[model samples]
Target: MSYIETTMKKLQRSSPGQPEFYQATEEILQSLRPLIDKHPQYLQQNIIERMVEPERQIMFRVVWHDDEGKVHVNKGYRVQFSSTLGPYKGGIRFHPSVNASTIKFLGFEQIFKNALTGLSLGGGKGGSDFDPKNRSEQEIMRFCQAFMTELHRHIGATVDVPAGDIGVGKREIGYMFGQYKRLNGNFEGVLTGKGLNWGGSLVRSEATGYGLVYFTENMLQAHDDSLDGKRCLVSGAGNVAIHTIEKLYQLGALPVSCSDSTGTLYHEKGIDLILVRELKEQRRSSLIDYLESHSDAKFTPIDQYPKDGHAVWRIKADAAFPCATQNELTLADAKALSENGINCIVEGANMPCTADAQAHIIATGMHYGPAKAANAGGVATSQLEMAQNASMIQWSFTEVDKRLQEIMKDIYQRCSETAIEFHQPCNLAFGANIAGFRKVADAMLEQGLV
Candidate 1:
C-alpha cells in the first residue's frame, strides 16, 4: 500500500469514530505526498507516523454548580498535538459540539497553522462540551473555575498556552485566569486574549478577522483583483466573522451576510457592522433581531436553509467567508456560490469546508484560502501577546496591528511562493500544508526523536 494509504488506515484504526480528525489527517497527508516524495529522509525517520500522533491527550471531567445549585458534568479535552517548533499553543473552545474528534481535528490543523505564521509556537487545542449561551454570570464563573481547576495543572506560560475560541471569550478567560491566579499564586502569561488592563495585547481580538481580510486582499492583489466594491457573504457572528465584516467595510467591500446557530441574515445593500457588534458582542442576541433595525434584511432559519447547501452561500455575492464552524459548507454550497458568481472564498474558521466542498471550490477556479493558513490570524496574534507578556511590555494598538499586517503579508507571500515552486501556482492550500509540514518536519529531524 502507498505510504499515505497505509498511514490513513492506521490512523482510522487508532482513532476510530473520529471522522473529523481522520479527515484533517487525510487532507494534510494527501497534500504532503509531493513533499514526501522529494524527501525520502522523512519516511526513513518515520516522521509522518510521529507527527500524526499527539504528544499528549488530556481528557478530564469538569464538575460545576449552576445558579440553581444544580451539579453539572461536562467532558473537557486538551490535545497537545506537537511542540516541535516551540511551546504548545492553541485555543480553548466552550461549545456543546466540542468532543475529542473535534478537538483532535483542530489540534492537528494547529500544527500547520502555527508553522505558517513563522512564529515559535507549536500546536494544541482544548475545549469542553459546556455551552456558554444564556448561562447566568455566576454559573459561568463557577464553570470557568471548575474547568480551570483541572486545566491549570496541564498548562503553563512557557509550556502550553491557550487562548479563547467560540463560546469561550473574554468573560470566560477572565474567570479562568482569575482562578488560575488564585490557585497558582503567580501572575504569568499562561493565556492569551486577556483583558486590556491585564497583560493582554492590543488588537488581539480583532486580529483574526482583520488577518483574514489582509490575506484575502493579498490573494486578490496577486490575481490583479481586489475586494473594493465587492459584495461579500460572511458566516458566523462571532469575533472572527464580526471582525471580518468590519475589515471588509474598511476595505470598501459590502459584506451582506452574517449568521449564528439560529439562522443566517442577509442585507442586500450592506451589513450594519455597528449593529452586528452590538447584537452579537454586547447583547448576545440572535441574528433574527437584526430585522428590527433593517426591515428590508432577510433572515433564513437553519431549517429553511437549502437541503443541499447553506443559507449564507445562497446569496448572490462576489466573495464568501466561511467563518462559522467545521464542515458547515458542503459541495452543494460551493456549487451554489460558484453559480452565483462568488469566486473568492477564504476560510475564517478551522476546517469550515468539507473535503469535497474544498475540492469543488478549487476545481471551479475559485480563489480559495484554506483554514490552516487563512484563519491563522488569531493564533499569530496570540504569539504576539506571548511576546509582549514575556517582555513585560505592551505595544500600542497601531504597533501591534502593523505587525499583524506584516505577518499576514509574509504568510501570503510564503504560501504563494511555495505554491509556485511546487508548480501548482496559486494553490495556497496545498502550498500551506507543504510549507508548514516541511518547517515542523525539519525541526523535528534536527531535534531528534522524542
Candidate 2:
C-alpha cells in the first residue's frame, strides 16, 4: 500500500467508530500526498505517522449542581494534538454534540489552522457534552466552574492555551477563567476570548467572521472580482455567522440568510443585524423568533428542507458561507449551491464541507476557501490576546482589526503561492494542507523524535 493509504488504514483501525476524526484525517492526508511524493525524507522519518497522533489525550468527568440543587454529570475531553510549533492552542466548546471524535477532528484541523496564521502557536481542542442552551445563568456558571476544575490542570498560558468555540462564548470563558483564577491563584493568559473588561483583546469575538470575509475578498481580488454589491448566503446565527454578516455589510455585500439548529431564516432584502443580535445573542432564542418581528422574512424548518440539500444552499446568491457545524454542506448541498449560482464558497466553520462536497465545488470551478486557511483569523486573534495579556496592555479595536486583516491577507498569499508551487493553482484546500504541514513537519524534524 502507499504511504498515505497505510497511514489512513492505521488511523481508522486505531480510532474506530470516529467518523468525524476519520474524515478529517483522510481529507488532510489525501491533500498531503503531493508533498509526500516531493519529500521522501518525510516518509523516511515517519513524520506523517507521528503528526496524525496527538501528543496527549485527556478525558474527564464533570459534576455540577443545577439551580434546583440537582446533581448533573457530563463527559469532557481535551486533545492536545500537536505542540511542535508552539504551545497547544485551540478552543473549548460546550455543546450536546461534543464527543471524543468531534474534539479529535477539531484538534486535527486546528493544527493546520494555527500553522497558517504565521504565529508561534500549536493545535489542540477540548470540550464537553454539556449543553448550555436553556440552562440558567447560575447553572451554566456552576458547570463552567466544574469543567474548569478539571481542565485547569491540563492547560496553561505558555503550555496549552484554549479559547472559545460554539457554546463556549464570552460568558462561558468568563466563568471558566474566574474559576481558574480562584483555584490557581494567578491571573495568567491561560485562556483567550475573555471579556473585554478582562484580558480579552479587542475584536477577538469578531475575528473569525471578519477574517473569513477578508480571505474571500482577497480571493475575489485575485480573480478580478469583489464582494461589493454581491448577494451572500450565510449559515449559522452564532458568533462566526453574525460577524461574517457584519463584515459583508461593511464591504457592501448583502447577506440574506442565517440559520440555527431548528431552521433557516431567509430575508430577501438582507438580514437585520439589530434584530438578529437581540434574538440570538441577547434572548438566546431561535431564528423562528425572528419572524415574529419581521413578518416579511421567511423561516424554513429543518424538516421542511429539501430532500437532497440544505435550505440555505438552495438560496440563489453570489457567495455562500457555511458557518454551521461539520458536514453541514453535503455533496448534494454543493450541487444545489452550484445550481443556485454560487460563485464562491468560504467556510467559516471547521470541516463544514464534506470531502465529496468540497471536491464537487472545486470541480465546478467555484473559488473555494478551506476552513483552516479561511478561519485562522479567530485563533490568530486569540494569540494576539495572549500577547496583550503577557504585556499587560490592551489594544484598540481598530489596531486589533488592522492586525487581523493583515494576517488574513498573509494567509491568503501563502495559500495562493503554495498552490502555484504545487502546480495546482487556485486549489486552496490542497495548498493550505501542504503549507501548514511543511512548517509543522519541519519543526518536528528539527526537534528530533519525541
Clash pairs detected, candidate 2: none
* Residue 142 shift from truth in candidate 2, angstroms: 0.6
RMSD of every candidate to native, in Å, equals: 0.7, 0.8
Q: Which stretch of 10 consecutive residues in model 1 shows the poorest summed lDDT? A: 306-315
lDDT of 1: 0.94
lDDT by residue for model 2 over 1-450, one digit each (tens)? Answer: 988898989988888889999899888888888788898889999999999899999999999999999999999999999999899999998899999899999999999999999999999999999999889999999999999999898888999999999899999999999999999999999999998888899999999999999999999999999999999999999999999999999999999999999999999999998999999888888889988888999999999998876889888999999998999999999998888888899999999998899999988889999999999999999999999999999999999999999999999999999999999999999899999999999998999998
Report the C-alpha lDDT of model 1 over 1-450, residue by residue, as the tens digit.
999899999988898999999999998999988788889999999999999999999999999988888899999999999999999999999999999999999999999999999999999999999998889999999999999999999999989999999898888999999999999998999999999899999999999999999999999999899999999999999999999999999999999999999999999989988999899878989989999999999999999988887899988999999999999999999999999999899999999999999998888878998988888999999999999999999999999999999999999988989898889997899999999999999999999988
Could you estimate the TM-score for every candidate? 0.99, 0.99
- lDDT, candidate 2, at 331: 94
Q: Where does candidate 2 stray beyond 4 Å?
A: none
lDDT of 2: 0.94
